[model samples]
Target: MTVQPTEPTTPRLEWFKSSYSTGNGGECVEVAAAPTHVHIRDSKWPSGPMLTLGPGAWASFVGLIAD
Candidate 1:
């Protein structure tokens, strides 16, 4: 699987937070989408480590969480 690299050499993305996110900032994540991959990072640390997933994997993850 290929991932959209967002290293220091790559441009940053406009990430969207989940609707479930609250001002309490307890546990929240942000996501950004590209043509072939989806990028996910911690909302509390936008510049921190990230997890990249392929389109199909992303779909399955979302489906599992939605169930």
Candidate 2:
């Protein structure tokens, strides 16, 4: 996976951690659902950089993982 630059100047966003995430915070990823795109970030660092993906791409990725 490629790491992108963190846009620290962006506005605040409400992040939702996956149900699969552990309370101890191991390999946790949070997703912020938006109208146009999906914003993903590490639950351990809410202020960190986010990877934005298109809705269709995100749905396909999730479907593959679900299977």
Candidate 3:
């Protein structure tokens, strides 16, 4: 089963890109943190689909990647 990304409606999301992102248009991602979930999308495609993860799942993913 494919889990489609949820798109936000109404209020605009405040996305923040990594400080490591260079001005040369390199690969980058942006994230918006909500109360229950975190939204992730490509920095170059602000209007594109976003991957939403619950707080627990997002924290676990971050922990793994930080290792």
Q: 5-62, model 3: which lDDT tens digit per residue?
A: 9877756779999777887998578899987789999999888899999999999988
Scanning candidate 1 in windows of ten residues, the lowest lDDT window is 5-14
Q: Report the lDDT of model 1 for residue 37.
A: 85
Q: What are the runs in model 1 whose C-alpha is more than 4 Å off?
A: 1-11
Off by over 4 Å in 2: 1-12
Ten-residue segment with the worst summed lDDT in candidate 2? 6-15
The reply for model 3, stretches above 4 Å from the true place, is 1-9
TM-score for all predictions? 0.78, 0.75, 0.78
What would the TM-score be for candidate 1 when compared with the true structure? 0.78
Error of 2 at 54 (Å): 0.9
Candidate 2: residue 4 Cα off by (Å): 34
Judge candidate 3 at residue 27 and give its lDDT. Answer: 52
Candidate 2 on 39-65: residue-level lDDT in tens? Answer: 999888877888999999999999999
Model 1: per-residue Cα lDDT over 1-67, one tens digit each: 9988665965558899988887786757899998778999999898799999999999999999999
